[model samples]
Target chain A: MSESLQVNTMADLMAQGKKPEVLFWVGCAGSFDDRAKKITRAFVKILNNVGVNFAILGTEESCTGDPAKRAGNEFLFQMQAMSNIQVLNGYEVKKIVTTCPHCFNTLKNEYPGLGGNYEVMHHSQFLQKLMEEGKLKIEGGEFKGKKISFHDPCYLGRANGEYEAPRNLLQELDAELVELKRCKTQGLCCGAGGAQMFKEAEPGKKEINIERMEDVEEAKPDIVAVGCPFCMTMMTDGVKTKEKEDSIKVYDLAELIAESNKL
Target chain B: MGISNIFFIIALAAAGFWFAKNLNKIIRNINLGKDIDRGDSKAERWKKMFMVAIGQSKMVKKPISGALHIAVYVGFVIINIEMLEIVIDGIFGTHRVLAEPLGSFYNILIGSFEILAFLVLISCLIFLIRRNVLKVKRFGFREMLGWPKTDANIILIVEIMLMSAFLKMNAADYVLQQRGVEHYIQAGAFPISGSLIVPLYESFSTGFLIFVERVSWWFHIIGVLLFLNYLPYSKHFHIILAFPNVFFSKLDPKGKFTNMEAVTKEVKLMFDPEADPYAAPAEPEGPVERFGAKDVQDLTWKQLMDAYSCTECGRCTEQCPAAQTGKLLSPRKIMMDTRDRLEEVGKNIAKHGADHSDGKSLLGDYILEEELWACTTCNACTEACPVMIDPLSIIMDMRRSLIMEDSKAPAEITNMLNNIENNGAPWQFSQTDRANWVNEG
Candidate 1:
């Protein structure tokens, strides 16, 4: 997992007197969680491969305060959000692409009201745009005809009403896209929304992730695809819980694209 | 005017007084919430009201229930025109006063009303069957177990009765008109009811026909008045509140959330490097209260209005991923609990003064933290609501209160917050290692 790449930070870019086309918001999970870090690397590799000029905030990048906001700590959330906003404003950043739906949702929806307005895109949307521009070429490779089920992250699907970009990008892999019983607007949460990823499951008859995984299992795909880091964690955990980790695999959409393109 | 007319006037006054008093109490209770300015884009607001409430646009998303609801809605509105004539006749003791003035137009109006009344009756009966007989899944949730189910049934039955009484009165009036009674003039059309119901009374005498007509008229008018007063107590209040709720709905993109202005201001002050040491600070908004809502009073007036306007149709709960996946959170229950808490607070204020606390709040006393934490903040509830009642906003506020005021978040979340605070992210990993995953080839 340890690989060296020329990732420029905002501070580095500012010092060099250069501006990237887009700011890559590597969210907390994508920054640290072992599995999510892979998504970050894959997304970054794709950006690097496509010759897209993108810079990370590096040590300056902080949590978007999405979990704090959703968990009811407005003070903490604002503290985090404003700190990041000041940094972005200092850099005069205009566009941001992130691999985490939580960050994507907060930066896109919750930030404008706080005077931090920018064009925020989820990595799936960004990847789709790259493909449309013919910058990111794909040859399907090993993913051709593979049975894959795409899980819609709650923030990406219902919150933002974006059910197409991720799916459209997945279709570019030339794989058999099997849909879960509950997909799109009716997509089930992987039980990590509303800061639930950071909290212990409340008393319930069954964990929400397990229930969501039931929908995934019903689709019976070789690969469970996710566009959000939180969904990746939950789905992977669900696969582990079901003891089907050896048979069923979970991959972020960026990971699949990067793997297929051998980028 | 005779003694009976005076009696009718007194009844009308009493009903009006009761309805107005209750409405005032509702307004006062809703005003208990903090003020928010929903005064922007008046034109857009009016358009939303027309499309969502008047046009029944959102309701039609689910075809069967939507169509039936539109029938009851259209019937209730159109029949009120005839109600105006009834009010005039009741006070002045004039029979069909609009009939003479409206002429053939009055006949067409009456015909439409009669048809609408029949439609209302049919729709209500179907709704009743759906609730009680067929037992629709959305309508039979645990939240709808007791009074809610009964309340829904009662409203349906009452509507059926009201429509029946209206048609019966019209039919009996037609029968008396046929008998050439002096007061029962041959005016207005009752195409369906008169043809169907008049024959049942034709064997009766003029005196009997007159008595039937008078009883049915009284029943219909009194029933309507009772229904008017009942609006505030029942879910059927949507009939009145849906318009305002839709009109005042958030006009921005559905995904956008309102940031706390106070927090934003504080953030700006913190970020500003050019601060003067001797400058007097701006006057704070009442000593900087708790960050998020803890009770009904902490919510915005629109949020409180949302509680009042919820029809409890369960479309929100039906679509909620958390609820569907057997989680504790039900968006419909959130709205209902807010309304219940608001009512409790209202009652406490009515009993004691406005500042009196009942030693309880919406948090522990009504809505539980478990339910609050169970929500995914997916906005499915907001999208599914026919009246644009945003249950997610209420849940988020309450969660805010819990975390900020009470510091009662789950242990795991507390750790995550600490991680975010210390590491600048929601993980224990150091920030320096964030970009270590990248490979140089």
Candidate 2:
């Protein structure tokens, strides 16, 4: 699988005088975090299977500075944003897709002010579009008739008003989709946003992620599907803490789709 | 004019003057914050104001509370039309002056007012039960325990009294009209008062009925005036400010964090080769601008107005992930603290001129660093605020001042910022290793 997976860089494609359809923005979590890497691989596999022309920025990419901005380091955020914008503009990138909502949000909403403008889509939206066009057919395989609950990522759902795309793809899996008691606009955060992922949570009666998992617990699903990497890490940690990792599993939307399609 | 008419004029004048004075003070306090341009997109702002503030679109999201609130709100606004007749009659020493002109429309107006007044009375009773008897958790949060709790109960009780007095006055007037008494003309319909309550007042003496009508009329008018003056001190100020506050709401997508143009310029300068590194920077013309809000004065006028517009409904806090998880952060407390501190700053300015130092700031004096840090920036608070009060923006701006100005942040956050500065990510992984996952299968 590794040998046959074709990955091209923007620099390589530029040297070859070719342009890809969309740039796959593997955000920091997708790039280096071991767990999130599998999500990136799953999304990439689906793109390849669907015959989508996409390229990666590879080493030329940098963080979109979402964490820095949310953590209130405006100076650092602007520096990183400007540098990323410079590289992105130099490559003449137009359309972007990412497995992380933070990257998608920052690139789509926050970057235009710093002069980085591109059509950015989360992997959920991209996959939903492919499914809409009839290019991607998910057979549901292992997830057929299984109860799957989606934890809405704050950035993706509340921040960006995107609640349907991921669920639309989930419906394609032929699964029993149960909604958490607090879902959509009232969706709870997984405790990893606002740069909380890099820092220990402030003293509280309970960790936020654990509290959020209580909603997942109540839903009692066989699988918890998520769209963001930060939510992936938090929800997975929550499953482990409840010792329900055996009974209930957490998978990104892309991984679920890729597995269903046997990508 | 009769003696009563002269007295009514004096009372109205005094209440109007007092309310105007307080309103002027609030405007000054809000203007103490830095100027911001929310004047763009007039059409969109009007649409939002109409939908959220007038139409009560966001209030109806919770169904039960939404329905009860709409009843009270619509009752309060629509019934005020009757106040116009009351005012005209009181000023000119006339009785039911609009009755002759409005004709059948006046009957319909009074009938609707009677119905709305009844609904308002019931809604107030339910709101009181929810607050005091049931003790809804949102109304019981720590920040809501003091004057906030009393203020909420006070408004509900006041509304109940005002509506009761209105119906009682109408009942006495109806009985007087049936008796064909002087100046008590058969003018308007009073369904609730005439049918249900007029029986209670039927047997009293003609003089006692007149006494009841006069006393009820005066009480209702004076109570409304007092409530008008009370708006400045109570969270009920949302009644007046919600319109403009929603009109000035941030129209951008919730994920779009505002960019710091000052930081952008400095970064652009760093990347420019022709720029002189040794040259002294140009001084700003006005007072040196702070990087982010350190106090209310550093915030924008719209943010300050948001504090004034907050109804203290605790919807934001109820939906807050941090507050739900028992973290120190409560979004309601942020808006309350901002308003409290702004009031304190306002008093200092009023007493000792604008240059006086209060030896206090909103950041450390009111809001703790832990509360700001506890925020997930998930925007549930902003989404839940019925009046569009954005508590998250204040939290973020204060965080900005803490980090950028004071360089004070959690050790982990400092490390994360350092990592992003050096390694192009929030962790220590080298940039070169970013794409290693591509071949790691």
| Top candidate when judged by TM-score against the true structure | 2
Pairs clashing within candidate 2: none
Candidate 1 CAPRI category:
medium
Q: Against the hidden true structure, what lDDT does model 1 obtain? A: 0.87
When candidate 2 is compared with the true two-chain complex, its DockQ is: 0.86
Q: Give the alpha carbon lDDT tens digit for every residue of B77-164 in model 2.
A: 9999888988988899888899999999989999999999999999999999999999999999889987999999999999999999
Tell me the lDDT of candidate 2.
0.93
- Give one digit per residue, the lDDT tens place, for model 1 in B151-194: 89889999999889888889889988877889888898988887
Model 1 lDDT, residue B315, Cα: 95
lDDT of 2 by residue, A15-106 (tens): 99999999999999999999999999998888888899999999999988999999999999988998898898898999999999999999
| Stretches > 4 Å off in candidate 2 | A1-3
Off by over 4 Å in 1: A1-6, A137-149, A171-181, A217-224, A240-249, A259-262, B265-288
Chain B: TM-scores of all predictions: 0.95, 0.99
Candidate 1, position A247, lDDT: 75
Best by lDDT: 2
TM-score of 2: 0.99
